[model samples]
Target: MNASMGPTLQTQGFYDRSTGTVSYVVWDAATRAAAVIDPVLDFDSKSGHTATRSADGLLAFLHGKELRLAWILETHAHADHLSAARTLQERAGGRIAIGENIRQVQTTFKTLYNLGREFLPDGRQFDHLFADGESFILGDLEATAMLVPGHTPADMAYRIGDAVFVGDTLFMPDVGTARADFPGGDARTLYRSIRRLLDLPGATRMFVCHDYPPQGREPCWETTVREQRERNVHVHDGITEDAFVAMRTARDASLEAPSLILPSLQVNIRGGQLPEREANGVAYLRIPLNALRTVGSMPARHGSA
Candidate 1:
């Protein structure tokens, strides 16, 4: 533990500014045991190429620090970048985990994509489906999964020690929070979730999943609860529930959908693993074409251009 009374969390962030997704390797320095949160797999949609460059960066960092990986945790099925969890698990030796509600997400998307009966929506694709309030130990470190579902029905925030890795739930103060316009997203519920996170001990540190600063600015992911409470534009301490909902709703309505949304949802909802490869060894990504239009236009969310 740090002298400041915070858990001794050694975190090295590997940011893919292209997708604006941050993959983290966090460990307890003393025990040399680690967990990787949301590692990215570099996918080239144009060339249909998939590479492990992003995850390899994390692997190299872990080797440098001499830490053994204990678990691979996903904050939620991401909608922006492909997850390298499977590749990392193969190289790092740990089981993959996600929120139990992923089954609900998978079932919803599977039907939208018209996937066949062979696909099981029970989250069996993942090694572990963490329930809300579930706690697990990593060597001496304790990590708790909190259901903070607003970005999607299956969103989760991992509270490891005093530092919480809030996926799309909230961002650094300057960036505001994630949009609540995806399937199953509710602005009111998101507000409550943000409040719950802010209520954590005033000193608790928040490690956000992504950060996008202005041109030439470096991405910053670590901030304190006290700082967010005082300065977050959308959910600062004095913002009332109704006000936040109104602000969030208005902002969401004006935004555009994520560029990768079409391809992302189909793959992410299945635990970051790609869809079953088709015959001839080609992996096919199904696009519902006008399906999203029928569901209503999606407002843009933060992350990726």
Candidate 2:
């Protein structure tokens, strides 16, 4: 374990090759109080099958180390992978939590999916909702929530000790920042949020939720704030907010929707629980046909110039 002051902070990252996601387990050596950040449940979009293998690995680690699970923290509502937060809590025990702005995401998807009145947008799906700059405890480590929305309205970065779990906010310097075309996501807002994160003490360890590596490189999830500020393709030290927004918007226009966006959102908005089953005893995910517009985002409407 890496020692810091009286409490030692240690983190282990697990990469799921399928979605290129990196889930982390961060704990203190002096107390063994731990939290699982952005856990994933193995999902097969083709077969519609869900497995516990990925999360099980995390559980085994916690058990092996005799660590007490305190929080199952989600940085945001992901569009790429199914969340294993609920499953992890069930097996290992932790309070499921996410950014308070998840209500905005939940409300957006609830309308898109035409969910019944039973599904509330009150953020009740989670055990706790953290607001921006909220302070909390992780064993002996002090943590704070920094709302970094842009990829989505609810994205948050958790700062614990010298480490930060930045959920889809910023990526490895080469991979750049996350696309900010999702509903309720503004390129300008995201750029500002990212700049705020980069302004932190340079040596701060920034851990990303997903890593899309370049051809010559293997997946990497760790980068320092100093490195990101110096080399991040999307928003480095010299990149202005206006320029970043233009680049981000243009880039998002050319990108296709994530392969698992539909399935992931339906499940994730419910705090990783599948939609309630019908009388047939089966839970089903709804795919709203053409519900998401991706044909062309040309700002000029129709023939207007």
- Stretches off by above 4 angstroms in model 1 are 1-7, 293-297, 300-305
Clashes of each: 2, 0
All candidates: TM-score: 0.93, 0.93
lDDT, candidate 1, residue 131? 96
Put down candidate 1 lDDT per residue, 1-305, tens digits, no spaces: 01122557677777787787877888887798889999888888777678888988889988988999998999987878888888888887888999999998888788778888888899998999999999998768888999998777888999988788999899879889988877788889989999999999988888888887766767878889999999997899999989988988888887777767777777677666787677887788887866764543465334321
List candidate 2 segments past 4 Å from native: 1-7, 294-305
Q: Following a full C-alpha superposition, what root-mean-square deviation does model 2 have from the true structure?
A: 4.4
Candidate 1 residue 221 Cα shift, in angstroms, is 0.7
In TM-score terms, candidate 1 sits at 0.93
Clashing pairs in 2: none
**Residue 251 of model 2, lDDT score:** 78
lDDT (CA) per prediction: 0.82, 0.85
